[model samples]
Target: MDHPASSRAGVIVSAPGRRASLRLSYANAAAWGLGNGLVSSTLVIYLGLELGAKNTALAAALILSAPQFLGLLRFSAPALIDRLADRKTFCVGCYAASALLLLLLPWAAAPGRLATPERSLVAMVAIWSLYHLLEYLGTVTLWSWLADLVPGRIRGAFIGHRERWLLVGTIVGMVATGIGTYLWRSHIENSATWNPGDRWLGYAAYALLGALAMLAATIPLMRMATVTTTASRPADHVRRRLAELLAPLGDARYWHLLLFGCTIAFFNGLTQSIQFLYPAAVLGLSLFAMLTLRSTMRLGQIAISPTMGRLADRFGNRPVMIACQAIVATGPAFYLLATSQAPWFVAGAWLAWIAYAGLNVCLPNLMIKLATPHLRAAYIAAYFAITGLTYGLATVVGGWLVDTFRDERFYAFGTTQIWGIYDLMFFLGWIGRTGSVVLLFMVIEPGAKPLSQLLRGEPQDATK
Candidate 1:
């Protein structure tokens, strides 16, 4: 029943060493990446390589769309998570379940004599979607904990530091995964040419490593600080619920922040939808090449995430976020020109990746500060829903763009059109993200005053 200010203000907490937080976040990020690299990156390859799903474009859309279903389930998860006394339980439990499901997925890859290959593939996709759903539910809940525990005064630094560490974990997990996948791909799966046995073996290897990382990741969350639940009065719960749903729009300032954030996410969705397509098409990279490029991009996130976090904490989340979006929006032009140069395309990809990481790390801190105390869960859930919904549909549009002009040779058009709707994505994505920037500057400004100030029906902050 206590507000964040009342509960958190006098709490004696040490700003832990960068080392400790980084290590924990790294371990956590690694567990997911190891599993994700296998589940997401590898399974995607598996669909094409093993199941022989020739509808790569459709398959891509379906995979990206998985989160929409997950988000739908997560619509209520924030409510439940906030009520649960132990975040570690939900976070670790969800991750463990996802890992277990992933390990069992090899069975879903191919049909036995009893189950047809088509049936098996469908089952595999279903299981994978379940995994995404679990991940979405677990992750949003787990992340809200950081907002709860870390003091907003130091949040940007802490989160940035955490992100950098996690990026390290991601890099380590991804690099190891890429090498293993490459080895398995070349020896067993045969990327240039396909082999079913090699694929089964490769998938198993990926699953085993993913399981191991999951186990390791689970350790820290179990060992980490717990969020002890507080009791709520019945009337208070109802009042809170009403407040939660409307808080984001209760103020003109928040209207801008939320508007800007959602806009940015809309663009990000469009860009991320085709993130894989660029390297695969414009640069003509293979699956291994795709993984390697992505891993390489994580290196930038590792280096800059903490810095951006610190900047967010010091300079404020809005400015840092603006910078982040600018960097993200502008990076695509480099990719457009790097069509002939693989390394340049990778560099552009890395820059975009780094910008996205910075934006993500900082934006959460901004929201944590802006959220109504009784309604924190609502704010978090709303953000995810907005982003997830955009991402789901973005993939379909992104796929259509690519497929529509996929085979249109540049020479035929006076220059090879940069692979389908790549140019349009760059343009549209920037437009959407820039909308965020304009909304933020014209509307929201950081003025530290209690929510009670607004609740008292005081005049709003400057937005003109």
Candidate 2:
């Protein structure tokens, strides 16, 4: 691979020193966690516990899954960035715009009430969709920029270290939000006529803080190195650019990778709509308990990130990713077995995060490795775009499924009655997630060792 600063045309974009680049990357990653954790971590819980949305599943589909429906915009960002040739500016602008948009959530609720009427919910969805659209544009550029700043030789460590920073920020953010919500809930638990809209005030405050964090993170983003090579620049010919955009559709390997990604996205979307709902509505977990459950998962990711990164570096992303899927496949079965408020359920949830650490570290790197340098943005765009469309539809369908079976149950295991719809969906998700492993082998990385060699503990060169 070419050096971080130089491109195929032998042009040298002014580069930040390695230490500075890593520092900036770390800061940016932390900022992302802090800002996102505040809004996204407890969004579904807030909807039910605070906002009192009529249908939590549908609300989640609209607010959380709405981003995926905008995936085509992400696919086009690379070409847009190519023409602009100024990734840093675009990324910083996105951070600013998202920060401003987040303040509108509280307003999405009905006047003086915590509930989001359908009209307000639609407006909220539109705002969130716009926010995510900008975020996607920034992400395409940011990943491309990072790929340029960090050399291929140490990319694994770089991504691993970056994830570590992200975890730290996420943990802190979650804790802060958790504590704030907990105290607020305690004061109002017994109050008569305590308007649910009151909680939106607190969330609005939290969201503002998150928005500021995003702005703060942009400072470091602005300081990062800029790539301005002729090679990095997009083709001026509109016809040529259009042709390149559709070129990935013809590559067998790209299709294989895309298929694997879509499988994961579909199941993830299918389960994500109800991850909080199952615990709250089915398991009857309190807010504190939910916090503990989520914390366990995040903590597991933190502990295993460095090790997973090293494994990916020593072996290859493909093998590590396959192992991750296998580990995650068994997680849903544990949830199925949780019949009460037992410690085992928490323990079961933690198992999935152990696998998530590996997946989180490997998948992005794999996307980068799968594409040529100049075409990296285009490939990433396509990968996200395809997965986005699949997940977007899945989330809505999953939400509808939940409402359909909210009061239904069927006898299973000879006397135990399971929530018929959710249980069935969980089993299907397990199958889909596990089945995705089959397609991983079909993806060919240029310098990666074969799966057979990897399992035999043989080291293969990955110095592409």
Query: TM-score winner among the candidates?
Result: 2
> 338-414, model 1: which lDDT tens digit per residue?
65544455566465757777776866766666665445656666777666776677766666666676666343246
TM-score of each: 0.80, 0.91
Specify the highest-lDDT model's number. 2
Per-candidate Cα RMSD to the true structure, in Å, reads 6.3, 2.9
- Stretches off by above 4 angstroms in model 1 are 1-6, 9-26, 42-49, 82-86, 111-121, 189-197, 229-232, 235-243, 249-251, 271-273, 340-346, 404-427, 430-436, 443-445, 448-464
Candidate 1: residue 361 lDDT (0-100): 84
Candidate 2 vs. true structure, TM-score: 0.91
What shift in Å separates residue 165 of candidate 1 from its native position after superposition? 2.0
- Cand. 1 TM to true fold: 0.80
**Deviating ranges (above 4 Å) for candidate 2:** 1-16, 110-116, 190-197, 230-236, 340-347, 411-419
